[model samples]
Target: MKESVSHIQGVGPRAVEQLEVMGISTVEQLLEHFPFRYEDYAIRPIMEVQHDERVTVRGKVHSEPTLRYYGKNKARLTVRVLVDGLLVQAIFFNQGYLKNQIHLGDVITINGKFDRNRLMISGGTMKTSNQEVTGGLEPVYSVKGSIKITTLRKYIRQAFEQFGDQIGEILPHQLLSAYRLLNRRETLEQLHFPTDTVQLKQAKRRMIYEELLFFQLKMQMFRKLERQGEKGQQKRFNKEDLLVFMDKLPFELTGAQKQALKEILSDLTADHRMNRLLQGDVGSGKTIVAGIALYVNAKAGFQGALMVPTEILAEQHKASLKELLEPFGLRVELLSGSAKAKERREILGALKEGSVDVLIGTHALIQDGVDFHHLGLVITDEQHRFGVEQRRILRNKGLRPDVLFMTATPIPRTLAISVFGDMDVSIINEMPKGRKPVDTRWAKHDMLPRVIEFLKRELGKGHQAYVICPLIEESDKLDVQNAIDVHHQLTQVFPEFTVGLMHGRLSSDEKDCVMNEFAKNNVHILVSTTVVEVGVNVPNATVMVIYDAERFGLAQLHQLRGRVGRGQAQSYCILLADPKSDVGKERMQIMTDTNDGFELSERDLELRGPGEFFGSRQSGLPNFKVADIVEDFRVLEVARQDAAKLVNSEAFWKSNDYEKLRKKLEEQGVFQDQKLD
Candidate 1:
């Protein structure tokens, strides 16, 4: 199984290269390339098969299959076969090799989708004699360029025959019996070639359990190690001070906000260092909770720092923090890459001398020579935007400061527990009083005029609107709209109103200028990409028009729609999309059905899986090959419990049985830099 894929029969150089393109380099990798889906195509009578249904039929060809050419490189093969006294015709597109592979009087089985009176077996599995190619319950693997599912299946079968017994079991014998799971080798065998639905289900259960259990074990281990060391600062909060700060707010905090603040305040005074995650939906009043933490830290004679992703967000936080804390005589400062040299020097001096009670900035805060007098709390806004190493660099500036990570993207509770298992989580599920839900509408491309008129009406009412495009420039590959082209067309459509364009290609200074104009209402209609998905806040914006809305995931669409509806007036999110696929249309329907981010996130997971939920690079989701959080949630729960028990038990770590497991986890690199080792 450890041999190169080239060692397999029929896997020539071209085939090996194609297989490597799909990440199958070794025999083990080929075996682990599980099927994305399965179809039951056991041989059945052709007469009984319904139209438009897919089935497998066994019969003998009446005559040799012949190829007909339409062009130099285009051809089709047609074959007539007799199945249970019923005549059926099978057609294959661009497959001229069937002339040599299948002949007259050959007893072959073919799997295909049945049409009105023909079996259209385009790229179907074919087996000669009495042996079956796919057997029953055909497995369909993900394919790349020039690679067919049949080819993958053939190679995998050879691998199993050669190395099936060499596959070692990773799970403990006790667990195998306790969970009633098949051993590793048997599970692999059944998964690749299942005879019945029950066999497939059992094999899938074993694989899913193993994937989820390993991830849970790694995360729970991190959680256990976090509590073992590192004494945190004991910053006690004065009730009178908190009440005085609360009175200064223009609006009262909701019960949910108060509860989240209470939890944060409690963590600050605890002896253990606080590693907490604060999750809330867009416009759910998370800023105030973070503000309270900063104020409390300042009152305890420790300076605090808040790091944001963008410079505009840094300036916004500085302004808001100044307004909230300046009356109480707390000094606040902003540090950014664009800051003047003299201004930066002054701010750095203030930060080091403790005159700056609270400092807010982008990554500029972590620059060399920027020292803190007594940094006690570190608040990171939109935490997912920053990498693990970046967060560590900021935390290292202070002596084990209390870390509070905040994100507006609402993750499902089960996923949140598994991903951020190392940190204590506080969710603000409730919105502020008098907040109205955004009126959402899904429109087709033909309704562009109506959507345009609606935007005009909102603009006439003195409210601003936003227009988002998925792409920045026109490309030959994609047919979707681009920000540049959309900006030009929009300018022509609405000559009276100012239209602006913003995307990733623009410089930071240029983006800041464009966003500032939109925020000031200088540009009535802003055309942009996902750059505004996170930290841009404009209360006057009341209408959002997302071109090609089907291209975005549910959470992204929700976040874009959230840009509007922040003001008092009624807001509307007009989604202009006419997706041709059912999955795309279903995503659009989910967007229109609810304003709840968490609910939409779960639906997004179910529809597109976790890879799309959070992109592969930044997704906090465990990178499991077979485990799906939405479908295997029950297994995930069991794994979480088992992991917690193992991490807590003193004997498990000392036993030889878990030595290899521990080594594999160490080499995985996810836990390499953690304190657990």
Candidate 2:
């Protein structure tokens, strides 16, 4: 690869600037810019090109191209090509430049999908060629508006020709031979300019394997460090302490919950650091499992801290833990950013002196002045909500504290192994007995009145409801309904009932007051945004009415539905969305068809990809340029096994065979702020 893309042939300064917009500044980056889709350039006769099929046809222009205008500033250019006395119409939308490029009786090849009528090929690639077939296939890249596909293809071809042999293999020969993978040079060549579908598939597999293998290597490195190198504070606890706490609970533990608790307890007793992820669906009793871990830590004469994303969640955890464990002589304290100065000082003092056994709070727990005496366990709720640095800071409070991360979001096993590969994972798939599935449905806008009546009936039955909207207020930019407008509308529609409004724009105190009212059932209807997606848990709220539901992802819709169905009463989730697009309809149907969070999560990953699956702000997900965690699970397994084999070998660490691999991992920044010492 050349030092810069500009050094390559045909990539001038302007071309370089445009390429940089697509994240290509170097020749290697240009080579790595794999095609997102492919076009079949195997030429077919003009009459044989089927409708809605992408194909390439070479023929002579039978007549002069004609340009016609539709609306203001909109024009369509039409040209007819003749192949063996058969005339085929080819239309290009807004491509007036085609009049100057082609003329009467000019031979050319067109690559695009035939329109539904099978008479014309619209919005496709056009190149001047006398041959019938351009090649076996063509690479179609994702390009900027100003950069043409032909330009990108030309530059990339030059890059490969100039430095193709210079692209050396990074993987060891033995490993490559074992995997039967092609070298980098061949992979890049086939991916960009493949001769057949089989070659393309083989080259794609090689690249995917390389990406996943390197990612797995880094993750395993972290795992090995945590298990073999990091020292953790091992706490000593009597079995009776857990039994006593279990006996005090008002409910029975499910088998899954018991298994999770057992695994966490086993980790706590181990000499190595306990870095485990506790994954459970909403209302699956994860908090109780965490409560048990905290109790065990306290019983061993150590302090444990639980961090949540919001103050309301922190408060809920603190209250619930205090009620459950205080009878067992455990002192629970709540600290958050919203706590008063006096309260913060008091809590800090008690925490430093070891009087507080379990502390539950938000980011305030990791404040500079906050200290813990013999801090042993750290539990973080909604693991993705916090950054790695934030969690590290909390862990740094103690001398290698045993860490337990908890997430109410049900992650698929494949995703769990990829994202949280460094941590031992424990899943609580079973809900406690008596929790019924929420009845979910999607309705059109015309069904709003019926939906409102349904909510009224639920509210009349002594239950509460949540009315969620996509926006906070009216926006000229977006046509979706807003929470504030919905709140007023609901208030006017149901004058006899009390409706409350809540959104991110509200102050902390206002949010707390509104939520408190809703929880106490003082507000029969709570209208809010996705801000209530996480912390607002009211058992009496049996109905969730999400407006513009098509605008929400499946995972978030599942979370909103989880807000209901927490009590003995039957619950319902009514999704109101305009199912105009196929994607919209598909998402709505998925929400209505299943209540399984794990299934929805997997489907979400499939439909929306990883970035939107958990959301863009989600941390810890690997940024692989080619590998997809959902589609490449099989490759990931192969890579994971290979990484394990390497990490297990004692000689590999000191041998020169893995020095390049080690340096690559170090340069990847996968180990953030890790001390080499």
Candidate 3:
């Protein structure tokens, strides 16, 4: 019990507040805050320093050289040290206080993280010989605000020491014994301050493996528990509705769509609830496929629900879905946050009265008062947008409505399984008619004038353009482009042009109006932020200019670029960066090179790795121990095998040996009971 909850040592209300600010509470949570990466600050003898090969050197402070002021207090303290006939230069930064610590010719051993820059081995944060200095790799952790590195190391070390013996081991005794995993206490202790690099690797593996195993077990167990649920949505379609709709489609359905439609159609028509995820890259006809599912439910005289992340997207989906269902004499209603009070009241009344066949909205759909007549099919666009609670709320609305979650974010298979293993998946790998590729490029701030001129020409030709600024308001430290400021700047450039602005802070009505203007091409140069990412499909918009493109993740940049290229015109995406870094260059290259969203997504994961992409932003993925998605494909395969074995029968769920496992989940409030009756 103590392992789960925390009574942290020496932490009072004020310290707790600081830890809470960093999003940590319990002891378990604190333990999960692993090192970002290790920094190898191994103290090397002065003789080990090579002419060309770079290394860290430590020796006595033989002399304190004169501090020559190099403008703006940019002065370095250089000390000569005699050690094993290798002269070492101990370079120091802004260490006015260290001057007294190191008296003239005092015996001092300096330590710094050094690397070869040309012929110079640059140093950082070196320590004097007051404390016992040891040469070894150090761990770096992610921190918040101005917390000193020394402070963080101290706190982490304390946590490890105090709670080291109490970390309740969760890996089954038999499994651990078989796998030869180090005891939980030992692993945690070794990870914080490893005896050696080898031991550190071992600790990392044990922790990562535990995380992965726990999550995989979680997803599998949840699905197992869900399978026991006798409740499921009533079937709303037969051969009649599907044949009727498919025959009317303007083009022939690709085999992939046909398969996806079959998967979705069968799930809706079946008795068990459809907890399925539909994955396809951009330009794939996910909307149309979703429309088919909705239409099936509508034709069967049952209601459906489509939940989206934003009001603009909800409204757009409402229109698009309504248009698709219109020919069948079906009624589709929009119940977004922007709806006038009277109109919203009417919509709710209609929903409860079973008059609304298919209702589409944002989070408003999950309100307690909202009711559905016979909600048989539920679909969430960009499914990762909503949390588990939100999904549960909608499913609980009407007899376990068959849920079909859709995403244009094409995740890799290993990541896909780890992140969304609980959901039965369907792939829609095909795109629609005549979707032209958007030309992409990497650029600097200097390219902005040329980019603007080009967009000006396009706008002059009656082709609308989107000039996107990343930040909505000015940030004190970052000198990046802000939406309001850019709107002002663009207005000056194109005085007569209609420019619309939209961001998160706007009221629903204001956002709707701005988005509608941009969608209808009334706003020739829409100067807004990422608020338009999931909004309407503005085909006529030919240019997409993203300012400070480096600030965006590759996946997000792709999503932004996806807004344009919808129309037949040659769409162009201009990515603007300044003082380009490595990741910056990669993001720009991904945008300019390929329209394959799946490829771009894979590349993005490769660059940033699985942690940020499949981690906390979209929580509850089976965390890897040391198995990298790119590097550890084999381990994933093994985990997949184990998952299949565990979920295959009632034995695993009923076994007494698994009771401790169940209790652990219960303690974390992870595996909760969801009644479906």
RMSD of each: 4.1, 3.5, 4.6
Sorted by lDDT, highest first, which candidate order results? 1, 2, 3
lDDT (tens digit, per residue) of candidate 3 on 1-677: 13432365666666666667777777767776667666555666544555554355655566775455576867676666654555556667766556667766666655553333332234555566676565676666777765556666676677777776667776667667766778787887777677888888788767666665656666766776776666676675568667877888888877788899899887777777788889887777888889988888887777889999887788778778877888888888998776799998898899888888889988889997898877788888887778878877897798767888888878876667655667788887667757677888777898778888888789888999887888998998888999999988888889889888888898877988887887777888888788777636888988889899889888888888888888778988888887358777767776778888878778887888645765454644434534554455445555665665765756556887666666777775546742211
Candidate 3: where are CA atoms >4 Å away? 1-42, 45-56, 65-96, 118-127, 134-170, 177-180, 340-342, 443-449, 473-476, 614-616, 619-637, 649-663, 669-671, 674-677
Model 2: weakest 10-residue lDDT segment is: 668-677
Tens digits of per-residue lDDT for model 2, 1-677: 64899899778899988998888898888988988878887777666666788878788998899999897788888899886576778888887777888978788888777774657787886877544455678788888758999899999899988988788777877788887888888999999999798988889889889898887777788778767776677888888867777887899999999999889989899888888988898899998889888888999999999999888888889888988889888899999887789988999999999999999988888889989998999999997788778888998999888989888787788767666666789998887898899999889999999998888788788999998999999997889999988988999999989999999998887998899999888999999999999955798999999999999888889989999998889999999999688988999999988888888877887788644555554566657666776678778877888888888897558788777777677677645635211
How much lDDT does each candidate structure score? Answer: 0.85, 0.84, 0.74
lDDT of 1 by residue, 534-616 (tens): 87888999999999999988888998998988889999998999999999999989988999888888888889864466675
| RMSD (Cα, Å) of model 2 | 3.5
Ranked by TM-score, top first: 2, 1, 3
**Each model's TM-score, in the order given?**
0.86, 0.89, 0.84
Q: Once superposed on the true structure, which residue ranges of model 2 sit more than 4 Å away at CA?
A: 1-30, 46-51, 59-96, 102-105, 118-120, 129-136, 140-162, 474-479, 581-583, 605-612, 615-617, 654-660, 669-677
For model 1, give the RMSD to the true fold: 4.1
